[model samples]
Target: MKFVIYKDKLVESVQNVSKAVSSRTTIPILVGIKVVATDEGVIFTGSDSDISIESSVEKHENDQINVEVIQTGKIVLHARFFSEIVKKLPDKQVEIEVTDNFHTIVRSGKAEFNLIGLDAEEFPRLPEIEEGLSFQISNDLLKTIIRQTVFAVSTAESRPILTGVNWVIEKDLLTCIATDSHRLALRKAPISINPNKSFNVVIPGKSLTELNKLLDDNQEPVEVVFMENQIVFKTKNLLLFSRLLEGNYPDTSRLIPDESKTELTLQTKEFLQAIDRASLLAREGKHNIVKLSTLTNNTVEISSTSPEIGKAVEELQLERVEGEDLKISFSAKYMLDALKSLEEQELTISFTGAMRPFILHSINDQSQIQLILPIRTY
Candidate 1:
């Protein structure tokens, strides 16, 4: 493969595709990046079985030349070494050439490196997805959905299915639900495409997190293709192929309580601060449990007691309180994560009781909700 490319553009493409390169892959060739230079552009692909990322550096765009392909060919280069060398290149242009025997040379300025390249034909070919189940979503909205829900997925391997976020689509609504059994996050948004199509899938949390980092927040719409066992996220100059998690995601509808015994509207920032202070003491208790009790005059007390450590108590005045007075205990970490993920300034908290899970939602927006199961610290 022979290509002379702008160093800056080459570095960007290399770094983007390197996200999927894994050092522990069973396939030897999977440890390296497959580079293919064609007349139109230079494509870099990296994969580690579960996920694959492909990034492209076009020859030119908008009257600006990015790369010149001298001899169209393909080769696999060590991802770690290639990425590092590209980043530290001393010149504005990079020249790469791969001989017929798979010998490679990279040059820029006065520095030149010789590498033994692998035959690209040996690299695993990505599945040819002919399925027609595809949809288009705004890049920003998709990123928001992943950010708001992926955090709540279980990290434990005990329940493998819980390690992924459950995505359900009905008509034009797309709902994402994630939980570790201790805390749950739910978000909903409108899907303008494939309104008549309906399907449920469990997307690995780690995949979503990586894809979110690679995706850019642009006004353009990205195409999402769903296959029998794979999901593809395609954006301009980038593509992410992720395997779908097998097994059924538990139905979470029954977990949320229909009625609440207590409801309170409070300033999100103030309540979060109070909880933060209480968590300092709560952490000493191992459980990181913080207690919230209703007080007089539309006020609530946030407190934590560590037995070995002293207690922390803070009062937060609420905008409104209704239903009944209540006291609840929950994990400080979970509480903080749920609050930070929300975009609302004012939140309405509903408590069923000290034992049942409590729910938080924006006063104006009901589409997104966070649920934290209370701790038994009576």
Candidate 2:
């Protein structure tokens, strides 16, 4: 393949596609990026069996040429070396050409490098997903949903299905939920476009994390196409495909209590800070646990005790406290994570009891909920 491309566009495309390149793959070709030059534009593809990313640089956009293809061909080059070389090119333009026997030459400014390229045919083909169901969501909203729930996915491999986030769509509503057994996060959003059928799928948490980084915080709509086993996220010039995790995600609906015995409303920032300070002493202990107890005069006492270290206690005024008195202990890390994901100034925390999980919801937005299982401390 021979093409002369603008350095800025080339670098961006390479960097985005490189996210899918596998460094420890048994297949040597999976470590290389396949570059194809056609009449339409130049496409860069990277895959590691689980996820694949393809980024395209059009020949001309808005009457400005981004990539000028001299010949229509294809080649695969080492992803790591090629990305580094393109990023450090001295000039604004780079010329790449592949000759007989897959010999490649990359030139820009006064620097030149000869790389041994592999036949593009060796690269594994991306799964051909039939577009059975599709929908669109604002890029900004999708990123928000991912950030709120992906953190709660289980890191342990004991329950492989719990390592992914569950996505369920019914009618025009989409709900995302993730849990690690100790805590859970849930987010609900309205879909702009309704699919022909409903879907319940588990997507790997790591895939969503990488895809979230690629999305820009904009109002532009991103097209999502879902197949039986694969899902494709398409934006302006980029496409990301991820394989769905196999297995049935456990039913978590029953895990959330329908009613609470106690409810407390407080400033989100104040509560978060109190937990942050209380966790300092808790971190030194065997379990990073913090205790919260309702006090008189509508205040909550946050404290932590460690045998080797001293104790920390702070009283914070609550906006409202009602129902039965409550005292609970939970992982400070889990509480902080759930609190940080909220964008509200005020929050309502509901407790079923000292032994059951507690729920948190934003005062203004009821679409998202966070639940944390209390840690038992005698």
Q: If scored against the real structure, what TM-score would every candidate get?
A: 0.98, 0.98
Alpha-carbon lDDT of model 1: 0.91
* Candidate 2 local distance difference test against the native: 0.94
After superposing candidate 1 on the true structure, give the runs of residues whose Cα lies further than 4 Å from its correct spot. none
Q: Model 2: how far is 283 from its true place, Å?
A: 1.9
lDDT against the true structure, per candidate, is: 0.91, 0.94
Worst 10 residues of 2 by lDDT: 190-199
Which stretches in model 2 have alpha-carbon errors above 4 Å?
A: 192-195
RMSD of 1: 1.2
lDDT by residue for model 2 (1-378), tens = 789999999999999999999999999998999999999999999999899999999998999999999999999999999999999999999999999999999999999999999999989888775765888999999999999999999999989999999999987889999999999999999885444567899999989998999999999989988877888999989999999999999999998989999999999999999999999999998779999999999999999999888999999999999999988999999999999999999999999999999999999999999999998874
lDDT for each residue of candidate 1 in 1-378, tens digit (9 for 90 to 100):
688999989998999889999999889999899999998989999999899999998888999999999999999999999999999999999999998689999999999999998989999998886658788998888888898899999999999999999989888788999999988999999885553778899999989999999988886888988888999998889999999999999888988888999999999998888999999999888789999999999999999998888989898899999988798889999999999888889999999999998899999999899999999978
